[model samples]
Target: MGSLALKDLTEKCTTKYKKISVTKDIILLKNYCHEIANKSLQILEVNLNNVESFKNISEATLALTILINRKRVGDVQYLKLNNYTLPQAVNEEHIILTESERALSKNFKRVVTIGKGSKAVPILIFSGCDKLKIF
Candidate 1:
């Protein structure tokens, strides 16, 4: 594939993604994904394929840079899937997107606490992913 402007790439991705039931919050994810796909040799490098059952949000964010930055700096390798279930509730979990909870609130399976002290924020809540990475 040839090099593409981020805007153009984002537009293309928007067009493609519109066909799916994917939520609008994932626009960030899609824009990043398209940027990575256009700029890298490995098409799937910046996709959610790196997400694993035990992976944390921070680690996944780092992986996404390789997947969406449009600069190929990392080796592309497929991650194995692990079956897991979503938790009903987890304390101190962070939900970055304000409205994410509404869409996936019922599907949470795990949580991660963030920042200083025990009183810190719950920075991440995740749904079970057997073989998918959704940024």
Candidate 2:
């Protein structure tokens, strides 16, 4: 068997996603998902001791994780309680992170779980998400 080079096909090989306005569509999808996620969170927060509320919040959190991170649904569907925790990446003050960036970093909690291909997928959650209490 012999291999042939077809440089002429490179332009045609571009995926549709690369050629179209994927950003606009994806951003709109995420925006809609965010609204539902936020609503579910609010309901859960207000009914802290309700069992049904807990389930709704858990579902919302999972949906948010999958959407926000753009991971394969299978990747995070198996996460356990232990997977959630404070940020594992050390923030070095000397690295020159902007004040705004640093402030934003404080709100994210890091969760690494083994996903497809046995790779660790990091899921970042808002710090206050610890209140899920669904364990």
Candidate 3:
């Protein structure tokens, strides 16, 4: 399931149960936690008007907690699911990287640069797409 969907499910579960019940499968729990974090980040990226700012620090800590708790869950392969961060792996790709970039720039009012030393990359916001000339 997608991160947002998983997070919605997790939120519902947490609300319904009030307290989370742990199972023997630590991998599953860690996966859920990681997805939750990704979902939170997605919400921020979308820039929904009614949504409050998502807290990254707390979410990161929560994910770490789950990882620590699931020590015996084998080598859990955690994957981050988000449009700009990681592209969909399947042949039928849902997200187009360039289009996603444009959409995110319009919606979130920021560019999502994917690379090392991205902070060092100079940001020159322009009036039109063609007007953008990165040196």
Candidate 4:
């Protein structure tokens, strides 16, 4: 009896709920947010700081991080400071990386955090971020 109900629920979700994506709209949003983020950073540098400007930059950062990494909100939001700022881990001798991979490795750093079911999840952050090179 319980299995029947579960099956019905799954079937309804599969048939009735359709996933849709608007690529054009998403691109527009990303572009707008990117501009706002850059503007906010410039304002902050000029010491024209305000709560509103800070909020806008923070929101933009969160949106870009999620979009770029295709990560869940929960996974990113709950990330600890230590986990995110940890030194980049180099692949051990057992791991083999292609030439392009080696070049890319110089650009980005990985941060690992615990996710659902205590699984390890990795997020990539550009290495220059610590040097204030967010853009």
Top TM-score hit: 4
Instruction: Supply the TM-score for candidate 4.
Output: 0.72
Relative to the true structure, candidate 3 reaches a TM of 0.26
Clashes of 2: 0
Please list all clashing residue pairs in model 1, or write none if there are none.
Answer: 46-67, 48-133, 86-109, 87-108, 87-109, 92-122, 93-122, 94-122, 94-123, 94-124
Which digits, one per residue and each the tens of the lDDT, describe model 1 over residues 40-123?
Answer: 323345554644422444344444433333323322122112311234443454455457665666554332323233332322
Off by over 4 Å in 1: 1-30, 34-103, 107-110, 126-135
Better of 2 and 4 by TM-score: 4
What tens digits encode model 2's per-residue C-alpha lDDT throughout 53-127? Answer: 556667766766776677887877887766653336564652577888778877866678899889988777665
Write down the TM-score of every candidate.
0.25, 0.55, 0.26, 0.72
Worst 10 residues of 4 by lDDT: 126-135
Worst 10 residues of 2 by lDDT: 1-10
lDDT of 4 by residue, 1-135 (tens): 699999998889888866666898779878987788778777878876577777777677667667767889877667788786566555683158778887887776677888888888887765433334433
* Candidate 3 lDDT for residue 96: 44
- What is the TM-score (0 to 1) of candidate 2? 0.55
Q: Please, what are the lDDT tens digits per residue for candidate 3 over residues 1-135?
A: 999999999899888845455565666855664566566556766774424334542344334533543322121112112322342243323244577665654532122232343332212222221121111
Off by over 4 Å in 4: 1-17, 93-95, 127-135
Q: What is the C-alpha lDDT of each candidate?
A: 0.40, 0.66, 0.40, 0.71
lDDT score of residue 31 within candidate 4: 90
* Total clashes for model 1: 10
